[model samples]
Target: MSLNPIPNQIILLLLESYNLGANINLAILMSLIWNDLFLLFLSVRNIIVFFGPSPTLTKPLRL
Candidate 1:
């Protein structure tokens, strides 16, 4: 098993949004954006988590 939680989070988010009465078009758009954002977030998080500290530190980051 992988350590990443992105896939599960995305699935839950999609399901929750659907349950909240999002239309097909809106759901599709939201899912696409959500998936992209989650992927970006996970990649950056993995880079920092696996690589440790670097010289690029300038300010605190938020997810």
Candidate 2:
């Protein structure tokens, strides 16, 4: 299985933001973070649907 690089990309963004004399574009940074989180949410939802709710932490009852 290939490793997800989302966290790596985020870490790189944070490192770049801390660089001396960095441009620090908040709009682009915030958009990237928001995009990643939205995608992660969608994937997690899909997994729950695939596996059924009983295996999840909340363990919602299955119909």
Candidate 3:
């Protein structure tokens, strides 16, 4: 399996931010953003894997 770099970078950045100061709100926001980005990346990867070359097409059904 291939590695995903974005999630790793997000985690590293979050750790760095946490170490900076007691910015609870910023930390939470960073975590949320990281979570959303990771989830989105995973979902897109799943879709691509599920539908290889000739992906199924359905106007109303989107991934």
Candidate 4:
């Protein structure tokens, strides 16, 4: 199956990072790292919102 555009772009970035190898500059590397982290944060937030909280995680404490 084909990936949607967001995932496809992320994959392309990963491949580009690999291809750059040891010659890659620090600024490009930092940008890639931050972009990936931001994407990960957004994905996790979307998943949590879509599913809501788990029952076990929301269980009330006993007195």
List candidate 1 stretches off by more than 4 Å. 1-22, 54-63
In the predicted model 3, the residue pairs found to clash are: none
lDDT per residue, candidate 2, 1-63, as tens digits?
A: 987899989988888767733545666788899999999999999998998777566767689
Stretches of model 4 off by over 4 angstroms after superposition: 1-24
lDDT against the true structure, each candidate: 0.87, 0.82, 0.84, 0.87
Which residue pairs of candidate 2 clash? none
Candidate 1 local lDDT, 25-59, one digit each (tens): 77899999999999999999999989887855855
lDDT of 3: 0.84
Q: Could you tell me the lDDT of residue 52 within candidate 2?
A: 79
> What lDDT does model 4 reach?
0.87
Please identify which of the two predictions, 1 or 3, would achieve the higher TM-score against the true structure: 3
Q: lDDT tens string, model 3, 1-63?
A: 977999999998998887776577779899999999999999999998887644345345657
Candidate 2 at residue 6, lDDT?
Answer: 100
Q: Candidate 2 regions off by >4 Å?
A: 1-24, 55-63
- Which 10-residue window in model 2 sums to the lowest lDDT? 19-28
